[model samples]
Every structure is written in C-alpha cells, then in structure tokens.
Target chain A: DARVTQTPRHKVTEMGQEVTMRCQPILGHNTVFWYRQTMMQGLELLAYFRNRAPLDDSGMPKDRFSAEMPDATLATLKIQPSEPRDSAVYFCASGPMSSGNTIYFGEGSWLTVV
Target chain B: GESVGLHLPTLSVQEGDNSIINCAYSNSASDYFIWYKQESGKGPQFIIDIRSNMDKRQGQRVTVLLNKTVKHLSLQIAATQPGDSAVYFCAEKDWSGGTSYGKLTFGQGTILTVHP
Candidate 1:
C-alpha cells in the first residue's frame, strides 16, 4: 500500500539527549505535517510544509525542535536536549494543500524521555 | 491560539448500539471539518469530513454532522462494535486568515469505550 512510513516506531532516551524521527510521505503528496499527541494536550500540530518549504512552525519550540523536508520522499523532525515533557507520539501526515483534504498519517513514533 | 475542544472526555457504549461524539470550536470561519479515530499506540485515522456548505456527510458505517451556526461537530457510528473503541477527534480548517495551507486545528479527543 502507498502509505506514509515512519522510522523507529519507538524510542527511549534520557533527558538532554537528542532524538530524531523520520517520515516518508505518500507519493505525489505536496503537503506534509508533523504533530505531537499527549494525554494533556491531545494532538497538536507542530509544523507543516508545502512543496517541501516550511510555511508555519509556530507551534514548535524553535530552540529545541526543528522539522525539515530534506527531499520530497523524506521529512525529518529533530529535538535537541530533549526533556521529559517532550515525550509523546509524533505523527507525520501528508496530503494536498487544499482547504480540507484528507491527510494520510503514518504509524507514529513513540518517544519516551526519562 | 485557536483551538478545538470536545464536550465529553469519555463515552461508553454497549456493543451493537450507536455512538455519538461531540466537539465544539471557536472559529466561525472554519469551512472544512474532519473526524479522526486514533487507537492506542497508533496515529489518528481519518473517518469522515464535511464542508461548511454541507450539513452532513456519511461513510460506510460512520457519519459526520456539522453545525456551522454553533461551531459544533459530531460523529455518529452506527452499530458500534468493540473495534470502534478509540479516541475520536474533530479537526477544523479555519480560513479566517485567508490561507489555505491545509493546516488543521484538532480538538481534544473523546475516548470511546465499546463494551460487548
């Protein structure tokens, strides 16, 4: 099936460590999104890109978090000096840039920072 | 910041019964809305969506209802089964900024428990 693919389905690390998650969006999908899900905040959009160019990342902590689409087939999210509060299931989604297009999501990467 | 929130935090329904989940948003210019179902340890899965111009939309066993006047949205699952248990979220696309980047603001999810 032509679905979004994410790497390292699960990750465990200590505080102050660096973690990176990778995602490959579906082919021909020009828009990619990165989201984080937690018990308290639910699902929040961290960042998004259109045509491989980032449009808005206001939801992300600019100092510790960064999202990049190195290429059309690969999008990466990295967190440096990760804190325990950063632990959450990070999801990558892709779809068109229309008003309310259906976004296809990958199996999220679960990260635990102890 | 603009946000979407749910009315109920959790819901329990007997198997073979119908299930209804509700959500509310603050943005009046939201033109599109979508419903997503997320199971434990997985990403959210798209269920259905409705446009501002339309009041309702239906899928195989699921239906989405939108009330633009009240900024309320609902998801209805017919013949709810055990497999239907999940955290359901309603997302809206607010065009108030005049941008169509497909960015969606998601609501706090409602945990649905289906008991057989």
Candidate 2:
C-alpha cells in the first residue's frame, strides 16, 4: 500500500545538536503537510506545501526550525540546536486538495532531545 | 481567532457500551470538520469527516454530528471496544486563503478509555 514515509523513526540526540527529519509523500499526492504532536499540544500544523512550493510556515519557529520541499517527492524539517522541549512526534501527511481533502499521515518520527 | 475545544477532557466507557464525545468551536463560517483518533506514541488517524452543508455523517460504527447554529460537534462510537480506546480530536478547516485547503486547526483532544 502506498503511504507517507518518514525517516529515522526514532531519534535520540542531546541538546544543541542539529536534527533533520525527512518525509516521502505518496506518489501523485499534490499536498504535503508537516505537523508536530506533543502532550501539551495535539497536532499542530508546522508547515504546508503544495506542488513542492512552500505555501505557509507560520506555525514553525523561524529561528531554529526550518521546513522545505526541495522537490515533489521529498520534504524535510530541520531543527538547529534542538532543545528538550523539541521532543515530540513529528508527522508528515499528504493528500490531494480536490474534493474530500482527506490527508493520510505517516508513522511519525519520535524525537527525544536530552 | 478560532478556538476549538472539547467539553470533557476524559471519558470512560465500559466495553460494548456506546460512547459520545462532544466538541465546541468558535468559528461558524468554517465549513469542513474532521475527527481523528490517536493512540499513545502514534500519529492521529482519520476517523470521519463532515462538511458544513451536512449535519451528520456515519462511517462503520462511528458517527459525527455537527450543529452549525451552536457551533458544536460530537462523535458517537457504537459498540465500543478496547481497540477504540484513544484520544479523539476534532479539527476545523481555517481558510485563510487559496492555500488553506489542507491546513487544519485542531482542538483539545478528548481521551476515551474503554474498560473491559
């Protein structure tokens, strides 16, 4: 079955380390989304891309977090000087913008920053 | 600003019993709504969704009810099983502009505990 794929399903890093998470959306999907899930906040949309172009990233902290879609197949979220508060499950979802607009989610990358 | 929240933070139901979870939203112009079920350590999975034009939608044993006048939403799970125990979130679509199709604003989740 075709589904959104995420790399480094589990990441453990110390504070101040640079961490990058990758996502491969399902083929032919035109919309890609990045979301962060934590105990305090459920699923918050961090960034959104349509047709490999960034449309919105206001939810992301500009200083330390960056999200980009270099091409149609790949999307990445990077965190520099990752802090302990950054520990959470980050999810990548993909779907079409037409009718229904049902987005399918990835397994998520569980990050633990100590 | 749109704010979506749940009426109850946690609800416990016995196995095989029917469960209903309620949600409230501040936006009345919002059109699309979705419900997601998330287990511990996992991403949220789509449960069911309803457009503003419709009042109710059913999928399998799950049902979503929307009331636009009061800005309320509810999920009804029939024959609740242990596998159905998880946190449920109600999300509303915020159309900032043309690029807001897949952008969803999620609400505080309701925890469902099914006891056998």
Q: RMSD, each candidate, Å?
A: 3.8, 4.0
Model 1: how far is A7 from its true place, Å?
A: 1.0
In candidate 1, which residue pairs clash? none
Candidate 1 local lDDT, B57-101, one digit each (tens): 989999988888788999999999999999998888766663334
Model 1 over residues A22-78: C-alpha lDDT tens digits?
Answer: 999999999899999876677889998889999889899999999999999999999
**Tens-digit lDDT track for model 2 on B7-106?**
4499999999999999998866578888999888777899999998899999999999999999999999999999999999898875546656557778
Docking class of 2: acceptable
Residue A109's C-alpha lDDT in candidate 1? 96
For model 1, what share of native contacts is present? 0.58
When summed lDDT is taken over every stretch of 10 residues in candidate 1 chain A, the lowest stretch is A95-104
* TM-scores for all predictions: 0.93, 0.92
lDDT by residue (tens digit), candidate 2, A1-114:
999999989999999999999999999998899999876676789999988888889899999999999888999999998999999999999988765567888999999999
